[model samples]
Target: MCGIVGAVAQRNITPILIEGLLRLEYRGYDSAGVAVLAEGNGIQRVRAVGKVIELQNALQATPATGHLGIAHTRWATHGKPAEHNAHPHMSGKLAIVHNGIIENHSPLRKKLIELGYQFTSETDTEVVAHLIAHYYSESHDLLDAFRTALGELHGAYALALMHEDQPETLYCARMGSPLVIGQGSDEHYIGSDPLALLQVTDRFRYLEEGDHARLTINTCEIWDRDNLSVDRPLTRYEHAAHSLEKGEYRHYMLKEIFEQPQAIRDTLAGIVGDDHVLTAILGPDAETRLVDIANIHIVACGTSYHAGLVARYWIEDQAGIPCTVEVASEYRYRTVVVPDNTLLITISQSGETADTLAALRFAKDQGYLATLAICNVAGSSLVREADWRLLTHAGPEIGVASTKAFTTQLVALLWLTTALAQVRGKPADQIAANVKALKDLPAIIEQALTLEPRITTLAERFANKHHALFLGRGTHYPIAMEGALKLKEISYIHAEAYAAGELKHGPLALVDEDMPVVSVAPSDALLEKLKSNLEEVRARGGQLITFACETIDQTNDSNHEIINLPFVEGCISPILYTIPLQLLSYHVALVKGTDVDKPRNLAKSVTVE
Candidate 1:
């Protein structure tokens, strides 16, 4: 994952570029850099190996002012995280910042080296700059040189390039990665995501794949892959700046964990009413298609993949449709049969996940009945490409470890499950009861947040542990996986999740006093079996921290700890149960003094393979 921002303004844009990089920090980056086309200095570039603050300080020591500039925050892929490998790489006449991998960079680098192009960095991006510069030497036209260089390259990229000769212009292009142009009065902005431009302007144009653009103070011109100029629709994005702020919370992760109640409420608003469940977002033929679907294929990666696993249980049990969940990266490489009348569903928070997008495109090439995306971003690539789209409305999740996004995804899946059940001629009373339960989820989530103080205390017991195991049964198994993922992501603990029934198969052997077993125990049909599983953990001398419903009588045991959770109806229990685990991870990370928002070696958005 990486971030790129470019600007062309009538006034100095160094401050804007730096601020944009600061906002893009949440995307996760190892190095920061900026290149500016100054009046007399030509293209002045500065880079730092650590944080954006380092880059800011570097710029202060050797200041550069310009009206046209580009900046980047890189999460290293092709090279080590160092000043030499940082972005805005220069090649005599051109400076470029890129946000994706070039698959053929090795061959191209070899060719360029043979042609007497000297390399200074171990990055695939450096080749692009040199290639463009080589083309410009012959063509003498910036756009044509860029176009020819792009034609010769292979792989995913979102590039921002500036030429020393053309100090007032910025050229940008995107293939697989995300890029957008923010329109402002007498100024124009380009960024990998809208967060970079939220403080500057809300009116922006999202570039489609294989699109290139030239930005100037007075004009913004977009060109298609075929070298024809294209008009991209400008949308007025209404995301408030305050939504990205931490407010009173110490970190965005904690604020997001507490924001789950409102996030789920916004996700379910108008879709679930007291008397009916709206299926209109699935398109006009949702009713007939839902009932006729033969199989359901859910594809996602990371936390979104765990959410899909949870939805598989709900879809099969409630809608009577056979469901299969697959990790997107693995699913794309394998030859899988896509049966007719099968619905393919994708889940993502940013909707820009590269693997998931590739899997969705692979499914599209096959003969699936329809495509549906349950995502947070409204106009993201996943939403725009799918036949049906449902926005989670979780707002901006800034933390590298997801909390609100995963819960809101479960909310959307639960709604989809009920909609399918209703279309399948399930009893009206049953559907209405589920809809009523859905309406009360916000209150239930609020009740769950009340347990945070107690969970924070419980987290002290886990803060020093080297490893942990999470256990759950039936539908809650996926919730266990997500809880384990959250704990390991933020706290740096080696955590693993096992279905309660699968513990004896292998994972139970790792249980000991040093390894705590955290169990997500809801009062469902599998409660008795889950209790039995907990007893096995207790017998193995594994310290226990169980999240159980209040009515469960397991608290009387003196050997184990029990954190009471709010009792909720039906499949909504998983969504409610996720809050305490999130708090546990946050508090544990806080206790360990780790970076709760930007975890090491992880990025919020995985835009590259």
Candidate 2:
């Protein structure tokens, strides 16, 4: 989940490499470093221990100019976040920046030590530079040395290598993680993402597995590991400039969270026109198969898995389908039977989640339909392998902890459910009513953002609390679990979500007056049961703050605090319920004086599996 960038040009390359690192900051920010090949001198390296801005300030303090350079913003996968553990690691005449884990580095490190190689940092990336230096010492050509060094390495990586001997060129290679080459008139660039090169050029080349590129001022030469020449692939792009803009918010997370209103509008734009409500859901063969499905297997990882859990409730209640939600990491190992007419659906933000991709392949091998992926990225592996696909219009989620992507997944799954119900001969009136309610959801979510202040105030009380419990039932059970995940992920708090009914089975014993219980008590068919569950917590001396549609004034309750919400249908409750929880986790982390943007031990993308 680190960021990688390199540029080869006749002119000085410091500015371009810096800008590219800024654009790729979302992928990583724990540490940053840059290496430039100076004209007369050897490779010059600079590194810092904070964000890219920190590195920028350091560069201003002591800057270097060169025609060839490589840079990285590290995410701390292999070692601690130390200045020495930062990227642009150098060994003798070579300097390199790398992404992904070297799974066999411990053994490889011992082997290198035996071969008389010394190390200055606790990182897997350093091993590569040392090995290349070892190879370059024996072999004359640096490009062949890089290929040979890579062949000896194990695990996934995207590497950018620069050396004093090869001052005019920058060498790059990719295995599991993403790396792309951008085409410009006078220069060719390699970066972790398109945004890094969007301002430089619209023309690009997609790097393939076992592919390596040697870039220069006016040309790019691609090759396989065996040194066989390869051709550059065609370009692909997005709304590059608009995406680069921060728009109106302070942080990208807040901006994306607020953009949900418009995002939801865009998602529902064509679903209801002059004629039909679920028209957008009708794909080529999707309607026919969905109507006749005997069961649905929803596979995803992390945040996407929470969305799948919500869909499990929706599809089963509305479309009369039995649904199973499985974690993609564990799905392949279990020997499960696929019933006839079963629909296997995979959900991913990038559509490149390694385990999810493997799970889709496993399902395909079992002779089920390839798969259907609900993904944001258009050309990702899961999307390409799927038999059918639904594209989520959430744009780009730069933040590691998801905000808009989860909401749009729920929206799309609901629409898909409504369409399938109609095809299954459900009353047209019921489907129309659900669509109308969904159309009104964006405004309700806008109103929900107003709860930020109250959530902030509540966050103060829980900042010192080391442990917490979240509770919900029915459609919102998954939301409670997701809320717990956000807090634990970003706030570093120990949190757990129980199915409300399960609290007394064992978890209730952990509750005391000091421990807070956050409850998602949205009105539903199971509301009475959930209300009873809340009363049990109150009886056991648990401090309670709840998100609910029921009135605090009407309840006459003196012990517990309630955050009242606008009345929305049970199916739509999770959408609105998520806002306050997100704000709660955000403010709690702020109050605890923890890093809210990039939490410790977590990366934006889990590319290495």
Where in model 2 is the C-alpha error above 4 Å?
Answer: 1-242, 245-248, 274-282, 550-558
Q: Estimate the lDDT of model 2.
A: 0.80
- lDDT: worst 10-residue window of model 2: 273-282
Off by over 4 Å in 1: 1-242, 556-558
Q: Write the per-residue lDDT of candidate 1 for residues 28-131, one digit (tens) a residue.
A: 56799998889888888999998899999999999978999999998666677899999989999689999766767889999999999999998989999999
Model 2, residue 243: C-alpha shift (Å) = 3.8
lDDT of 2 by residue, 1-609 (tens): 468889988778899989998887644357999988888877888899988899999988988789899988975555667899999999888899987666567788898899999999988889998888888888887987888988887666789998887778888998755678988878888987777888788778878767888888887899976778999775767463247466655456666777787567645543442222432233334555666678899999998999999999889988899999999999977897898888899998888888888899889867664368887765577766787666666777777788888888888788777776877888877787778778789999999898888887889988679999999898788999999999998888899999999988999999988888999877677878888898898998889988988543335255588888888876688888988888888888888877676788987667667
Model 1 / residue 387 / CA error / Å: 0.8
